[model samples]
Target chain A: MLKLRWIALFLSLLLGACSQHVVLSDDFPEPIISQLPQPVVVYISPELRRYVHRHEPEQGADWTIVFGSSQEKLFKSVFAGMFEEVSLVFEEKAIPDDALVLTPVMRDFQFSTPGMSKSDYYEVWIKYSLKLARGGGEPMLNWAFTAYGREEKSGRSAAGAMREASRRAMRDAAAAIVLNFMKQPAAKKLFSVAPAAKAERT
Target chain B: MRCWPAAFALLLTAILGGCVSSSVEQLRQAPVGVLKEGETIVVLGRRQNFRHQTEADFTRCVQNTLTRKKLPVKAEQDFMDEMFPWFQPRMAPTTAEALAKRLQEPAIADRLKQTGTRYIVWLDGITRRGEDGGSLSCSVGAGGGACLGLLWWEDDAEYEAVIWDMQTLKSMGKIAVEASGTSYVPAVIIPIPLVAPTQSAACRGVANQIGEFLTKAIQ
Candidate 1:
């Protein structure tokens, strides 16, 4: 009876292992090693907000596994590294009188299956349109960034591969935003320029 | 065994009876309000590649069905021509949000308002053939002709109709339609192909739902 019980337990464990859903980790590195002088507010575009929350996969693709936080939260974490203060907002709200706003639009996020051989890598790609707005002035900076991630392990199932690939792509995208937006001349101007000083209390 | 002919007839009827099936789901509900007299709702395909006849046929079917239900819908071609003249071919917004924002712009907003467009129906989706498998073999021998094998394939399509409320410049709601079926062909000596009206069937299903949704006739 004990041997039979042990066999049953082993079988259960094997089935459990086989049926486990892929879990990805959010290990996106901050783009900027150091913080900026002031905080930058981040707004996710309405479409992007809905899309991330919807989490609908394209046909023929397996379910996507997001690591720890939702896409919005993950984005907040990445942007938090860009400045001393980072605020993530969903709806269009009154921005701090002096705050610069960064709106990120997810134009496309795609996951592709592996090649004929299951060992082949799966591809994950993300496209972002980052719009920098200051005090309702014409968007000061409009940049589009595309990043790709590949899963090379043969053993990882398609969903697992997608998770890894998507995680890496997000990280790569964050890195690009940090470097491109922070280091650019316009971004410097944005950081240094004081929000139109409130009519000097005259 | 003499009843085999009757059995085959019954079998064929059964197989053909379930050839096409589609369902509509309201992912978002339409806002409560009556459209003003003479006000129009516009139907448009959301992709450039949709200029093909198949897409046009789908769009027209939806418009006609809605019109039949007493909803005032604008001609897709007219809407496209007036709004997106620069593109030569018709153009559609990249995203629903973008279109919403565009509709709020004075230039575009003024034009759309002038046309009395209260709701914009975005028809986006594609009908496609899906997985297929089977084989057919045929040959004429000295004794007679003999053929044996099976040929089959899948036909599937998905469509989403996202309704935008021009008044609020927001998405009122959306409806998604999914249809899929398998087509079979049998061969005794020569391959006989059975083509399914997959795309046409999907078109009708989506159009029927749009009609029902707009008319608020859905139960």
Candidate 2:
């Protein structure tokens, strides 16, 4: 009887062990790490706000801005200096109407540029989308520019220089837009736009 | 004689249990092909209409998060021939063999070499379905008592997936995720049960959830 009881206990323990999920905590496969350092959060500048306000006011103030497409980082850096108080918001409705509605058109603009390829332009678009989506509640701005150049020695068309120039121009344009918006009373008015009763009281 | 029978039954259960346990272990131990540092990971997005946008957005969102986490990733346009091969019934067997070889070929191998990538991740599917409580029940019998239990009792949007690795040409993992979001109108209205305020907002919620999952796995 003693021997039988011991056997039953062992069997029960074995069954219990088998029934429970065997999670291997330590033997996990090592994760693959990339060589490039993770990409930085390139800030958008106040200039983009100014440019958008100037170029497209209806969509500028209420718009959620997306940064990057080469020009994205530069725009962020420039705009960081401009906004007196800038807070990143992840609100979905905060996204700009243009980004949601005009993505394809923007992609076309990027592709049509002389030196920039479809893929390169697509990267910019994607990066812009990411910045916008991840912006939390912060405003978004989109800008992309590319140039064309000819090889000096071979007299062949060289796109590298042109692409860089375009990227720079887009960055500058984004910065300019933000700056312009900062200088505009329209921006202040939009923020200060009050209910009719509140306006009357003020 | 009764003892002998009981012993035989116990032995049989042990054998069956061991087999099932080993299979799960094998799945966990399955080798994943290596993707080295600086290697570009190309992800392709496919779906219909607004659904396509959602999937693309999610894919890009994952890619960006991964990149930010320091994974060298590239979103590519051209689909590789080896990755997807065309073969008719008659040529299926031979073509399948050839395709497998092609996947292991030097061209793809060389590109992988360029950045020392040893792993490739492929996202195959995402689906959302309303849960049916009646269909989720299971029965179990113990001693003289039997009972039915319900599985997955929730009001939510769920995503399912099959992910594969390029190097080993094997599936790395499968995941199922569900989330609930509030639906609100312009005015502060009573919220809908589980639907998100907007589809894009739902997509963002899903992306963040997936990001958290990936972070847990990769980190």
Candidate 3:
């Protein structure tokens, strides 16, 4: 009886060993795009241009351009090509004359628009930065664009591709800026927009 | 005397065999990140600004995957409502500890402590963009490689996901993947035509690449 019991126990143990399965943690699913809108045209803010040219004299102006945009489609196409979704914020700062001169100027311009909401104008601000950097002369422009997007809800695979696209966008923008600056005429024309002068009536 | 000796040997063999088999079975059944049998694992869920429908789907997928793995999983809500009352509300660690305790089948009120969870996966962001001509490429290697390259510029979408270590709060890794091809397929249906010949191909391509990276990291 004891021997039989031992045999049964051994057989059960062996069977259990063979039947066991390896277990892994749960995997998150891929993110799905419920909707994708058409690409909106990105434009530079007029107020930003007025700010940059406010105090400068027009004697062969050296110009710099920085770009920003908030249009979802433009962001998806351009900004998404440069950053990961985890990045909640993007910022670019320019230093002129070894002092943080341009940031305050940009900051004041960013908040200056009263009619439009913050989000609507954010995209405008981003686009202006890109154009300004192209136009600014001998000007060092730092353009930082940030994005907050869908993450693992779309799965890790989707996120990886998105990050790659974002990095590419940033590189492309930088290259475009360099290429534009190499051309002297293009650079000069960027900041040639003149300030409104006081008119005297006879 | 001969029979007696044979019986003794048989009995010893059976005892040794049982021990070996039990150990093997325990090891085989162990969950990822668990070092020993009976060790507990904790499943955690994080809240983000995601669409409700998407959130439900993601939650279901994760829960199903975990259940299939046979790792005891406790929802965040259950852990909060029943397991650990002493833990401050909205605290992730407390909830993690509570869940770990449940996995171990411990006394409900006993202070169940763990080093940390095996994995923490979270969503980061999603985006889409249209591609231009400069983005397309074709190779002339073999099967169908010599076909005309299609240059389509439609908005491409991407999703970013991150995995972290629960205890140390150190980021284990991050994966960002873009939607397959340039076509916009609504999220509700599994790609139409039964198999999305192109999008499915693209999704698999991206999945394989990211999956390989993830597997290598975990191993």
Off by over 4 Å in 3: A1-202, B1-46, B49-54, B62-116, B127-157, B182-219
Ranking by TM-score: 1, 2, 3
Error of 1 at A144 (Å): 25
True contacts kept of each: 0.00, 0.00, 0.00
DockQ of each: 0.01, 0.01, 0.01
How well is each residue in A1-202 modelled by candidate 3, as lDDT tens digits?
9999999999988755433121111111111111112111222234433333121224322222222232222323332222123111122322222221122113421211112232211111212243222222344444433222222213333224233223223323332332232244532343332211110110
lDDT of 2 by residue, B1-219 (tens): 345544544453343221100001112224333444443454433322112222444556555665676555565322321221111111111222343453355444444454444344333334343333322222445633222222222223344333345556554554444444332111111111222322233334433433443443343
- Residue A124 CA displacement from its true place in model 1, Å: 33
Off by over 4 Å in 2: A1-202, B1-35, B47-54, B76-117, B125-157, B186-219
Residue-level lDDT of model 3, residues B39-109, one tens digit each, is 33333333322232113233344444544445544454343333322111122232334433323333222
Candidate 1 lDDT over A62-153, as tens digits, reads 35343434457657766765466888776776565456888877788776555433534566678888888874466888888886666554
Evaluate candidate 1 and give its CAPRI docking class based on DockQ: incorrect
The models' CA-based lDDT, in order, is 0.63, 0.33, 0.30
Task: List CA RMSD, all candidates.
Answer: 18.7, 25.4, 28.2
